[model samples]
Target: MAVAGVSANRLELLTIADAVAREKNIDKEIVVEAIEEAIQKGAKSRYGAHHDIRAKIDIKSGEMALTRHVTVVADDWQPEDELEEFNDSAMVRLTDASKRDPEAFVGKEYIENLPPFEFGRVQTQMARQVVTGKVRDAERANQYEEFKDRVGEIVNGTVKRVEYGNTVVDLGRGEGIMRRNDSIPREVFNIGDRIRTYIYDVRAEAKGPQVMLSRSHPGFMAKLFAQEVPEVYDGVIEIRAAARDAGSRAKMAVLSNDSSIDPVGACVGMRGSRVQAVVAELQGEKIDIIQWNADEPTFIVNALAPAEVSKVVLDEEADRVEVVVPDEQLSLAIGRRGQNVRLASQLTGWQIDIITESQDSERRQREFSERTALFQEALDVDEVIAQLLVTEGFATVEDLAFVEPYEISDIEGFDEDTAEELQARARDFLDRQAAILDAKRVELGVQDEVMAVPGVTGAIAVALGEGGIKTVEDLADLATDEIRGGYEVKNGERTKVPGVLEAFNLAQEEAEMLILQARVAAGWIDASELPQPPEPEYEEELAEGEYDADAVFAAAPEGDEGEVVDDEVPAGDPDQPENA
Candidate 1:
């Protein structure tokens, strides 16, 4: 297109723009706009700089036009701050504009045609540079918009270059980077090698879109299975969870919507052909396809497949599971370096501890013996009766006292009358224990404010008082960690003592609740209000000089200064002198 007297074939200009847009993978409209802008710059150079010039291109016909624009304003109108940049040539007063066009009115735009310009070497080069830069920016924006929503999907690309163990892949229209850590262990890539990677993230950076790819991400395996397994892709089967050691072994939990179709079998395919394809892509990484279970214990058992679990004891509060397997299955359950159990824990979202049946039996027996002894001593019961109580799952005197009479009577070898008598004795013993704790609390001078805090019973008050936390203020000052485990000094070394929570037989949550309650009772915080987290304390550097105690004390407010000053007395008064 010829613009501002420049001799350029309109068809050639449009052809070049179309080719550049296609080559750069940018929208054609952006290229056209860039060309129009370049022409405008050239036009402005030829015409007066004070004139407002613009250029437009016809996409189909490749025709170019340049026009000068002037805004009509009232004769008395003055330039505001925003319009101050425009010179008189860029604006026309209504009276002056009306001389040329009688219909000209204020707030109307006046357009004037400008002659086409001759193309000079500098102008042509400048236009080309502008077109190149604008095309590049358009390409970047297009790539970002295209790939932003494709994160967590798998894409195929060719390795373009490798820098310091980071492989840059050319994804046809865009580029991606796979860091060394994100690749499978021992996996290597060469230039021009075709590879598939998971688009874990795409960031719009200052330079361009940063597409981060990964081969070791658990999602990568899930995506691969989706490509290989029709059932997963169609949603008949769902992959619940995946955990990978990457190139060594991996675990996947799959569930099926149709109970008739086994999720694991569907993922595995007949004779493991489908799974083998995934394994080959992952460089022979072992894949365990286990059926997912709604029940956590059952899921945990499935996660640790090939290892027979005899029993599972769940600690929901801690989100941990203790799995007991046969003695021979112990090694398999733990796997090499505990990889099996580790992956199982990750897959089930719970901490897994494996023990052999024999070990579990021994531990159970030890606990039973300890509980039997405690019941015998605390409840004044014989060894046989204590054993019976322990066998019935009554581990403490409190259990006997608080349990329903029917539950106590239901225990084998215990009649209704015997159960009632035992319950009465248990209650009497607990009453006596409470009285003793009350006396100890009083002797320790435990404050009623501390005792009144929720979760702080007579026993806990006594423990806190013994630990030198005798008042609500002292208790309130403790952190959650400190309340859960008291600070201790051993062998002149200060350390946090464990089992403080266990000493009160309280859970960690309960210990924190008690600390919050104490803080509220002490007026340090409001009820149902969360305390503000303490800010980090920075040490102040003191100036080198003799310390000025008076300057420091004088700034404190009233009682905070530590000595009361009489308002009636003037400083250095002879009759009434100040007391130090």
Candidate 2:
């Protein structure tokens, strides 16, 4: 107690801690931990006698508190080692009650509070080292939690240092690393540059929080849009699809709930104020804001902006698109080494094949020539023979393209020599017709209008000339069931299930195609307008015991027996109920 008041030793320790906390702008709790560690180390060194001494500091008033070592014991003081005698180093004293009863224990208590001991040169150095380590660890852990939630959120940070292809940014709260891959290719970060980046990933480590930032992620584009466009923020404009090549260029499709507001106009703002803001943040990366379309072809056309599209042919079943552009625009549509088409494909989720108008026309010409050559060969024989061949079904140029000489000979009135002659002539005709077809095909050039009947290839035309159901629009107008009936007698007589018509045997896929073609010809019809065949009335067979009413009436006894009467109402007679 004599050493407790105004002790020079304790006053100096308190003063040092209080001043350090204020000067460093650190918490008072940190200074208390420092002081307690210092005093404990000093006590252990000077009084090498006490093993369990604790100390505390009052940071506000610069006051010190101290306690001595003590250990608890059981009431029964029987010694585990009976052979050892008691010594000062580890001693126990019995109470008066223990002496009388022979079962009492020596109760442990703090006998005295030691004075604050002054540390020697070596002891003082060790204490400072321990305190510094603890304070730094606490600071790092606190910083880690604060920054972890900020992941995926955009933040402004200064470029502090760059090393090993990683950019270190000072986020004010902590430091973040932007790996080289996450940095946009077009962006060049430099020291002291104030930049905006998205926190993509965060992790805790033994040292501190590891924050990963990114500028190239697709989400970064969405976030940038959210910040730039108020319509997007309020949920009025929804981003339907977005794609980016990061620093170079990107395309985004947006849709609006209110049809009166154009999605593209809403995002662009007046004089492109909003989108320009986003572009500036992205270091002038070009962005195309397109109106989202539900129709795949329309959407694809929009995606390839700046390159005007002449046509878009969507093969939905094949999940592909054939985009046609003018000769001048072909290179633009495909972009530099197909980059534009590739990005458009990624954006629309469709495989894209780009073709120039002239190239497409040329390709069609070649196909048409090949088809026409095949048709002319079939037509080179006697008129009767050619007419019979057409009747048996070789109508189209494609039909006869692959026909063998033997198959032609098998037709009525054609001998092997004639078959050979026609086959050779057909090949020659194909050579000549190919050129004509090419000219026709080129003249057509990706037309929306369906062609007229392919030169007498219809049921009536074929009965009068050759192939039936060659075109879908023709098939739509024909009576399918009646055609099916007539076709079965001709070709499907051998099978258990008679084929009604040649078209009836078309594969499921071909049937669907025919339906699509029909739809295009007259536009799809409503179910109500299409005639529905009536259900057949089932005839009920008479049972064995059932007889005619006339027989029963004739067999009935005179007038008393109930008679089935036939009442015929003559022209002017009053009408009577049938049941009566």
Candidate 3:
């Protein structure tokens, strides 16, 4: 059949394939393959269905060829069930093929040429759809390959449109979307406006590749500073940590490798130009550039800058710190609605409790008196001896009971005889306390199963029984946090029971051990079992994406856990005005 413009035009085909490949950012070979497949399908439609059809395009000359392929098979070989139907068209017996070509042998393939035919309207439409679909699939694959590795990078794009609260950005070669929550607070962009955003995530979905962009991410601010500060970019200044409240406020802790250079000053730039540039980009978000310190107390003080801290008492077991300032600076340290202290906590990765100096002093004296009384009553000692024990850092009877005789004797004004006698009394008092607790546990009817759990002392068993957690099963069902710190509810004027850990003065690890033992005793877990958490799958290869200059600065070295310094600042004089 004769058809116009249906036969392969080598030059035009090659030119079209090249244009499409460049436009779609796909390999030219892929486009050529799609065209060849489309042509083969059209040829099959024109020729007899039984013909074995194949097609190829010459890369250099743009020549297209359609051929029928028949494989030579052994005469004794039987055709499979599915192959039996097309055996005559797809394959030829070696004996039969030898008649046509004397050199024909098994495994040899014979090719027959077919004249080019014109395409009908329907065939033309089918070919168009096939090429279009193949090109689209290739384009999507290319897009996924291009952007998958670009996650966590900052990219520039123009706003294409806004749907609901989400903004779509045209990234030249692709498109990205910034969800409403990922955008900085109160910041808006108009159509065609160019903007930079951090690529927090990229995923390949059935519809297309989804590039998630963010403007309020902590990494975004860190990257911005890297762009503005040469020292940060060059690795002389390192950003230890960053926390952002979006368009309101942010804090960054930085350290300098070179002693002569100040990290904060380097980030701030001459006359604050460098930081101002970053602030402008973030819509005037106030940023605090802190001098990072290895000493945690010093770091916290720097993080809560603009407000002076008179003292910081860290509770290492609880991972909490208490900061005391003058009464006048209380509001400043706490910030408006606690924003200052909250940012400080985030920056330092610790829980912070701010108090006035007077409040701290009162709490301190109360704790001292309680310790003194505890030592006096437990050791049958006078107030002077108890005071001495308390001042020597022995805050509880347990300390004296568990300590070596030499340790007690080392205390000022303590003779060996006196220390030995005190230790004996402390041990006797603990024994009496334990017996009383055991009696209480029995009275409360705590199960033997609960008592058998490791770390579940008689006192803890009694406390658990009073709280209505009687059986091993009940204890096993509690969450780690619930077991470590008991929940509390206050209604109008009534206060419910606090957590078991707080009630028994149990450490977090001790509570966890108790729960683990409970689980084992309840037959919920194996006796020798260890927790097997699923490991995170991370891509080890470096992504073919833009470099994140700030990422290097923000990457913290392992084993650099900041230490708490024992240094203390003098208490602020309430009568004197604070330093501005």
Give TM per candidate.
0.70, 0.48, 0.75
Candidate number of the best lDDT:
1
A best-first ranking of the candidates according to their lDDT comes to 1, 3, 2
lDDT string, candidate 3, 1-580, tens digits:
1111347567888888898899888999998888877777787777766778988888889777789999999988775775465368879999899999999999999899878777887677778877888889888788778889988678999999999899999888889999999999888889999999998888889988888899999999998888889888899999999988888888888889999997777788777888889999999899987777876777777777778887777777678888878899899888888888998899999899988989978987999999998887787779998898888888778888888899989887778998889988998999999999988887888788788887787778888888778899999888766765544556655444456556666677667777877899999999788455567443344668855555654453322323333336422224321111
Q: How good is model 1 by TM-score? A: 0.70
Per-candidate count of clashing residue pairs (backbone under 3 Å): 8, 7, 2
Every model's Cα RMSD, please? Answer: 21.4, 26.6, 9.6
Candidate 2 worst ten-residue window by lDDT: 571-580
lDDT of 2 by residue, 33-77 (tens): 865776677676666643566676676566676666544344445
Candidate 2 wrong stretches, greater than 4 Å: 1-26, 41-50, 73-112, 239-241, 257-259, 291-338, 341-580
lDDT of 1 at 315: 70
Of 2 and 3, the candidate ranking higher by TM-score: 3
| Model 1 worst lDDT run, 10 consecutive residues | 571-580
Q: With candidate 2 superimposed using the best TM-score fit, by how many Å does residue 405's alpha carbon deviate from the native?
A: 35
